[model samples]
Target: MSSSDGTAADASWERSDGRSRPPPTVNTIRRIRQACTNCRHRKTRCSGERPRCMNCRRVDRVCHYEPYSTTNPPSSASVAANNGAAKGKSPSSLFPRAGVVDISRLPLATRKSRQSSPSHRLLSINIRLPPPSPQTPFPTCQVQCMRFTTAPPPAVMDHLIDAYFLHVHNQPYSYFHEQSFRERVNYGLIPKCLLFAILASALKFSDIEYFQGSIREATEAYAREAWLAILHEHLTVENNPTLAERTLTLLTLFYIGGRTSSGWLKIGLAVRIAQDLQLMREPKNTMPPIEQEEHRRAFWSIYLLDKLVSVGQSRPPAIAEEDIHVQLPSDEETLRRGIWKKTPTLHQLINWKSETESSVNGTFTQTILAATALGRCCRYVLHGREMDEMPPWDPRSDFTLLNTFLLLIDHHLQVETPSIPQIVEHYRRPDGTLDFQSLEHVVFARIVFHTAHCLLNHPFLLRMRLQKSNCKVPPKFLTRSFQISCNHARSISSLVEDAIASGCHVQSSFYAYASILAGGILSLAIHIDQEKGQVTDPETLNHYQKAIHILERTGRRWDHASKMVSLHCLFRAIL
Candidate 1:
């Protein structure tokens, strides 16, 4: 029988019956080697890396390097754990029971484990935010759980994106030196996204007065065309089909001025490019032109276009009663005034339609006619045209128009996934880190600015209605008016303050826009007071203070003289 410590009187353990045990062998030592290192120790043949040995590696632990004698006999437990192979298994044995790993067989998995370092992980996490990383911000198929609720503000995210774009393009914002810019261009850095942002912003918000007053005087059609040509030339030079596809998607959301058929055609062009580049589809050996790939683009285009158009119709500008002259059309001249007219009273045009069936070039005659009619109306309002007669335009109910526009905007937001909030949180680490703090500031500024600007300063709508005199008024109308005015003022002020605090550089054009928006909101608040007999509520006072703070901060950076004028008007009207 074996001794109580389970060792025999030999180098290898033996049974109590007195047979000689084998010597401790290389196989046993090698098993111990792996077990030790895994446990980060030297070779020992014990079961616990706690006591690390050959037994330890098999049991998944380090082999302990204690002073246990190399001459000590193997225990029954150790031999049993090794399935009796420890005593006799050959060094060349492919199937050793001692848990020795084959280094050669593990080459691929080990290489992969080595390649996936921490930096790669961080980059993978960064790109999922709706704005994407600046270098390659396109969304991947990877889905990850995120920590935050809501998205990073768009203005802030845009800055981060811009930084990334600059880095990728290797274009330094530091120097406007033409040679440096050209060098970066040669290195494949074209500011496609930056240019796109500028154009889109101009298209969407450029007032006719601003266009006529400034741009028309400075730049001709040839200059604009040349700029576009440069962009096109770079897109060709880059041969970057993916970038082209992304550009198409952006244009679809922001521009691409047709509905239905034309939209489908444009989308078809995107899909064809995508196919050629294998971006959205498996490329066949051959490719087809836009006309041939009609089916691919038609479905998404029709669906997205209809969705966008409906949304556009919903956000019809809110008109007020006092802005329009109460009169009927007498002739074409009078009709022109009627076309420019705002609703003299809120419900007077409630039965009028915003859209009507008409013919354009083989496309959305209704949308084109509606846009043209609306544009004409807004022009008349801006020009202070004679308000003698109603126009020849068909009556479109205000409800129809407002609902359609809202729906279109909603659809675009959903499809585009721009500035999606939740995706941004995924980029943070476990302790909740964030990059591009400036992005947050810029985004918040833009949002607040747009909200206030669109509500207060849109040429077609009267968001604020100033009474000629604040004398007798119905209580309900007054209360409703106050509620709208107070809430909007508070919201605008709060957003502006938050934006400024985010450390958005006050000198940015975006910051200037925010200042302008604040000024307009303040003007609206003052107008509300004028309508209420020069009486300012506590909420109004609070909003005024907030607006003052924004002006003080932002004015230090931008020469917002027009904004100051608006602020002055606000004080005069209210006080």
Candidate 2:
């Protein structure tokens, strides 16, 4: 067997038979293990990147280091002295005196010595070869080489991280059209794997205390590659997961407005990646829960509806025009006669070869929901209007379930804290409070937020006015009570009257909760006065002013009443 100290690490000796024997493990190989100067310079956790590192290419960098293994064996005393160090010393210190034991120091032993000590025959050590140096195509593997132990270079690390984020931003997800576009959609422009790699790289590169923790959580949530492998594997086909992950990231970014461009790009990428996944023929099911939902929703909302609408299957006869005095059909009748009543032709177009539950029906339902939301969004965007004038959209009630969800959400948000428990409990019990996140809470939250966003076009001042003719009690009681029991019918009626009369220009949307609140306050004032038997106008005015100030300070505006309807008139001068 050849000695390991003075020859290239790959060199081997021929055995008596046909096979070649590995070079002997030398003092230097034991001392350095696989650690090399280049790896230390780059601070890369090397997988011993073969030919070159899969990780380095992801970041657009060159991998370089000196290969320092040879065939010569060091003396027994030298080996013993080096190994005698505390077990805690690193495995790469088999030569005690040399910081990095050079292969040149130990030359191969003679054939006589190999024969004399057959048990001591050298065995080859496995160490990664470094990439080529500038002067040579092959890496420098001199018998004598310098070594140091430290992290990788900062510039190299920066380059790697930057590459990772770029890759992620470029991941592809395309909109569905014809089957012919499948290849372009799936593999076109950017791929999903690149997007994952970017996120993983960002988390790895960030110096924040929670970066690692976030990566771990994301890895579990996104069902993507591990953080390291993002850079480690780059954009290879095996690494790409799904578009849902990209969509989820995009949605969060849209909501939060953090890293704006990066977030939006992720959405586009998700669309492309999703199309890629759709075209895949293999049976696979390792998607994360969030992704599964996004995938289902995206397909239904984006593609299936177009197909249905194209074939006239979803069309409804136009409703006859009538005067304002004519009571239009109830919201339920309108929806049933107009949209939901018709069956659609979407089923045929979406029947893929796989004999599984048809995605078409689910897509159809989702598309309808999406269309409704889109209508609301467009209405507000164009007309600058609110849904307060329209009937609620409860699917279970006269309205669609989606509309009811919006109403509940509006009611909840109008209150001080929009807890899911409190909103759910409002329908269940007026006095009870609930805690904890529930499925009902999440579903409603989704429905309400999406619909409200669709409906609300512009921001406007929200004001409340308590009527003097109806108030005999303290106003504080009314504000507190009405804010709590937001749905009490009588209170809502009173507030609506106040909002209509209030001269302050306001968006009609604010009237819903604000009107109810004003009525509750008026009732409270009336009750207080009745309890006292009689209250002077000045005293009533003082209470109204105090309560109004409280509301204003708390971010609740109530300036809508006519200027003549002053604080003094609020309690009707019941001194």
lDDT of each: 0.35, 0.32
**Cand. 1 TM to true fold:** 0.30
State model 2's lDDT. Answer: 0.32
Cα deviation of 104, candidate 1, in Å? 50
lDDT of 1 by residue, 1-575 (tens): 66744444443443334545455766674343223222321132334334434544443422323233322334554334334323343432322112332222334554354236432232222221342233554322111111011111223323433443332111101112223333443343534443332333233223333223333212222122223433455346766554454445434433333233443344555556654554322223254322112222222222223222221323222222233222211111222122232112112322244242111111111222222223333333333334323221213633234434433423322312333243234333477653222133223322332343234234224322223222344546444533443454555566556534643223322333444444455556666677979876666677767766665655442334335545665766776
Off by over 4 Å in 2: 1-256, 279-419, 422-575
Model 1 segments beyond 4 Å from truth? Answer: 1-396, 399-482, 502-518, 521-535, 555-575
Estimate the overall C-alpha local distance difference test score of candidate 1.
0.35
